[model samples]
Target chain A: MVFTTAVNFIRARGPDELWRKRRIFKLAAHFIGRKRNCYSIAVRYVHRALVYATKGRKLKKLDMKDLWETRIIAGVNEHDIDYRTFRESLYRSDILLNRKVLADLAAWEPYTFKALTDVAKRRAIDDGLASINNEHKVDGIITRGALTKS
Target chain B: MSALKRVQQWATFARIWHIYDATWQNPFKSAEVVKKFLMGLYKPIYHPLNDCGDHVIIINSGEIALPGDEWKKRVYFHHTGYPGGASWTLAWELHTKDPTMILKKAIYNSMDGNLQRRHTMQRLHIFPDANVPKSLLDNVSNQIRQLRPVPTRLDRYTAEEVASYPKLIDYPKDYIIR
Candidate 1:
């Protein structure tokens, strides 16, 4: 009897609930599913939603700095130096580069970024912050034999 | 590559665009321009019902510039929606207590006085320092295209011509009046 009642209730309201949830998600999902054509728009709205949620909050300071570090990492990626090593070196060498300017410099000009990265790497090495290799290190995966010679 | 990356890039570009624009115009007005740009007033597709707008990330709000005696004379007011219950904050005090308040006020002024305004205002990102979030950089590119066009300067002759025109009065300066 209970099972029958539950089935009847779901039959009467299940589709409505499902539709409502889908509609709510679709509002900001932008280009997902049938709206794949509007992917860029959807993506932008989602990004804005995240940014908005953190605004005016007292904890926003902690939140935004993380955002800066992430941008720095992405910018540093172009220079073949991961964010961790570069930042560690900066910290060790007492070199000061705020994340805001670093992110801007990285995005606006990648060539200058490469030069900066080279300088950072040199500084890191001088400060004895570079990682040292152990004999047990894994062998290189890409051998010369796999190369296609011209 | 990621949506987060794109938004951060857009925010950074928006900041640079605003700074350069301010330098060309008056640096004192940069805060006002930043507020307007974030409000979607300059977009071609702006519509009353739609909340289509760009996200604005404001960094170092503490370091923004103001013109003249604005820091002393400007007042921010808030009321409890009651008779004779208004509270006021002087600009200089607001700056020292919380510099971010100025940008927030500018943003609020730019928003429409409607229910949707609050929702749209959420897209403003104001950070007083370099501490932006880490999760926001998934797809940021090192390649930023600073494609903003320089605004045209007003012709000096146009203003001069307007001033040079004879001051036409209903009566001559020397005319006798009762």
Candidate 2:
């Protein structure tokens, strides 16, 4: 507890405290007061601000998913089908395309999406799915079932 | 850009969820579902810091239920910072004031204490009387299933259906059934 220099006053809290304050200051540097000599004030706001930054990252992902689903729905609507039937058909057919890929195909690759939709349509017909157009095309045709047997 | 890194990022960042309002059907159980949707915990890519939660449009919030005596006993506290500025409002009173407040407050308190939470709260859409705007109605792409079957009211039952409804032991002709 003996100190000969001014270093002791800042060092009294230990070297760890100094680095913690420095880290917070670095994070808050762009902001107003945290970058200044106000250590106590900076500590409280910086922690809260950092928490917000982290939470924002998660929120961004949720937003992206919503956007993707919407894009897919919009794209699907053009094909004379609702998103649910299209998606349920996709699931039943075991195409395994996630929302991101489905949305991309719906947006950029119309033919590819159409092909997938056709495949889903075929399976949907086989599964006796309700609420779809073109059920008549695949009805009473056991092509998939026949193929599996042969 | 390695393909593996690109795939990893895609897997980490892409997902949306859908929720249905079962509050009118089963109020107590529906709160947990609403909380999960608001928190964005249903997705594999969920992270504490990211605002990756999906938009939750809860219809029929005005008809939601509170189990036990919570509707009367549960109180929300606020302060104006004046001398004796503290005020407490019962849950039912708050619900009457703003039908959405119950769900909103439930979501708000469940979320982590952080600045980003307000942005997440913006995604919550509650319709008290189910007369929601068309824009919000369009946003509902899917529905979360209710935990319990919504019971049919007597008014909705047809004469045949009511007659067919299972009867308790036919009281003996001598005994008058109330």
* Per-model TM values vs. the true structure: 0.34, 0.50
TM-score of chain A of each: 0.44, 0.72
DockQ of each: 0.02, 0.04
Interface RMSD of 1: 12.4
Residues A1-150, candidate 2: write the lDDT tens digits.
Answer: 678898778857666777978987887787774344588887777888889989999998988888677667656655656678888988877778988998777655655676776676666655667875443343233556435633
Model 2 chain B lDDT-worst window of ten: B6-15
- Residues A1-150 of candidate 1 have per-residue lDDT tens digits of 234565577656545655645554566654445443354555566567667776747476765676567557656654556687777766665767787777666666544555567666655444445451121122222223223210
Q: Give the DockQ of candidate 1.
A: 0.02
Q: Which portions of model 1 miss their true places by more than 4 Å?
A: A1-150, B1-28, B81-84, B137-178
Question: B30-57 in candidate 2: lDDT tens per residue?
Answer: 6566666666555433445676677788
Stretch of 10 with least lDDT, candidate 1 chain A: A132-141
lDDT of 1 by residue, B39-121 (tens): 54443223345454455555557765566777799888889899998999898898798867786777676555788767656
Best by lDDT: 2
